[model samples]
Target: MLSVALGFAGPALAWPQSLREGLFGSRPSDGRQFAAPPIARYVSEDGDVFTLDRTQPRPLLKFDNSFEVWALTPQPAPRGDTIYKNDLGEPVLRATRLGGITIFTEQRPGGSAAALAGVGSPLRLAIMGPQALLERLAQASARASRAARRLIPFEAEATPASSALIADSAMITSEAVVRMTKRADSRHFLDRILKVRLVEGRKASAQVAQGVLEVTVAPPQGLAGRPSSDRIVQVAETFR
Candidate 1:
């Protein structure tokens, strides 16, 4: 009985024949290329129309919102090791041993695209559009290049709540002003700061997690007064 409830329901064209013909080209009058299935129509208690093969291991709904990205568990590939499939039945990206995910932009809606793992790992398909992803990559690349100078505030220890602060090294392009502030702890006494300076000589502050770093191209005018919090530090204490 339990098995029957989750039975394999194969593909069925729910749309009208005329619409289908318009989209997929003319249907054969003679029963050579096409033939109607034994069951012309089906009525279930739930009115959801069924399509696509049910028996095939349906890609897990890994991420779905406005956009969709489906990832299979990490597997060996010719170049690297992980395989990612899109909504359509196609493998669109690869994750290499060198620790980066290569997105085959040609396979995707656009042509030739890829993203790194840690920079923007576990990408949320819904909120991130193609242009957004590209912009993010550019920012991450800038961050990576300046990692030595850039003071990133990762917590000294891993816990539910931790505050890591960095001063003087986060910048943002004007177009990608998607600022979101978050509280890591209840008291808010302990928090991290992200200082962002825009290209046109403007700046802003966001309270973020230890892992979150301020990403931008050019350095701002002043960094000391940006956060205005005691937790903010100018340099790596351990280096000194």
Candidate 2:
């Protein structure tokens, strides 16, 4: 049986040995790039294994206590992207497409702006925290809470995409499950439904899930009412 014990050693899941060995290779478009599909596998702490064939946005693990989420792209990003960093000097490693959407190879989690541009989109994000395993429904709820609020105080010109979506949604689904394994009591289980709403970025909001930290964008409306592909092309061509 899969081990759900709080302190026990997690499962040992591994990608095909040959596939794992072949992942870190170069492609023709750029000398420093490589393709990310056909064989990328990330295993969760509970031995749940996720194999990447193409770039899909999904979490790596979900359980009653803890979880891990991961997003992968097929292309490689370049080396000099500024979206990889925040004003605080922390590094971000997921790519989000607002207008432009391209995926390069070398941009694992942090690529240079110059490198990231090749892949399209200026925003990239990744959220890894203690409560990473709530499943998609709960994750969406958390995201909606964080995205529904506005980040008035700004230190930079850019805004985060995930935060915008959450703020717009406002209400999070209450049915989503929140699982927990208490640190004090390993055998005990603490499961509940978490409802979150963004009150303040720096200060605590009226609604929030305890033990969960969120990473998201500032302005919540940037991604709303996104234009169609044809409209985007027309606009780009008009500028040209």
Candidate 3:
């Protein structure tokens, strides 16, 4: 069912020319060119599309039109299957060894068969100059502010050696804001947040306190480091 359910794809192009059934069990088009982490796309019966990236320590899932990234925990299921759950311990999707998939959504609590949408891109951060990185950080900040419907000032101090980390740290902060805004349990916390600041540290960490979102980044872990997107959101949730 590669039908472009929505107009997201133009008339000239269709999504997933030959989408299969089991995305997780299939191999990528060319593993040699992209010697990177795995990514998979799945669509539900209600036309909900999501991409899962296994680049991070924990698998991360993100909706096509949303900025919120969810950290998923994989649990062993019966019949050589695996169940993926969100931070709330709610099972969101399940996969079998034989390339079968079933997803649980609000519309389908009993689970719907997930269609393998297409091959996903590797979760690789683009290498850019300092100015570009700063611009990207600013863009991410503005997006988060718009999503939260508030003026959340985002700032980061970057040294010559820590420019990329600083930009990524700011991005992580902005993503956390989006994540917080999406959840009813943590959305109110964004109202109380005034600013988000990211700085270099010996280790990565994030916390929300006193109307501020503080993020610290440690290099060496490079682009895929600790204090993931949802972890920062979870930190904001703790305030409430």
**What TM-score goes with each of the models?**
0.20, 0.24, 0.64
Tens digit per residue, CA lDDT, model 2, 27-93: 4555544444322333322232333222222211112232221222123345432122212223333
User: Which residue pairs clash in candidate 1?
Assistant: 103-114, 105-112, 105-113, 106-112, 171-215, 171-216, 172-216
> Backbone clashes per model, in order?
7, 29, 0
Candidate 3 residue lDDT tens string, 1-240: 011112122122124444452334445566522122257667766777777676667676666665344557799999878898875578978877666668787679899876666555444333456676668567767878898886777777766556666666666677677767778878777788888888788877787778878887776655444466766777777875
> Which portions of model 3 miss their true places by more than 4 Å?
1-39, 53-60, 67-71, 86-90, 104-110, 147-150, 157-172, 175-188, 200-204, 217-230
Give candidate 2's error at residue 179 in angstroms: 6.3
Each prediction's whole-model lDDT (CA) = 0.27, 0.26, 0.65
Q: How large is the C-alpha RMSD of every model relative to the true structure?
A: 20.0, 17.0, 7.5
Ranking by TM-score: 3, 2, 1
Off by over 4 Å in 2: 1-17, 26-32, 37-181, 185-197, 200-240
- How far in Å is the alpha carbon of 105 misplaced in model 3? 4.9
Instruction: Give the deviation of candidate 3 from the true structure as CA RMSD.
Output: 7.5
Q: Where is the poorest 10-residue window by lDDT in model 3?
A: 1-10
- Distance (Å) between predicted and true CA of 172, model 3? 5.0
Q: Which segments of model 1 are wrong by more than 4 Å?
A: 1-65, 69-73, 86-89, 106-240
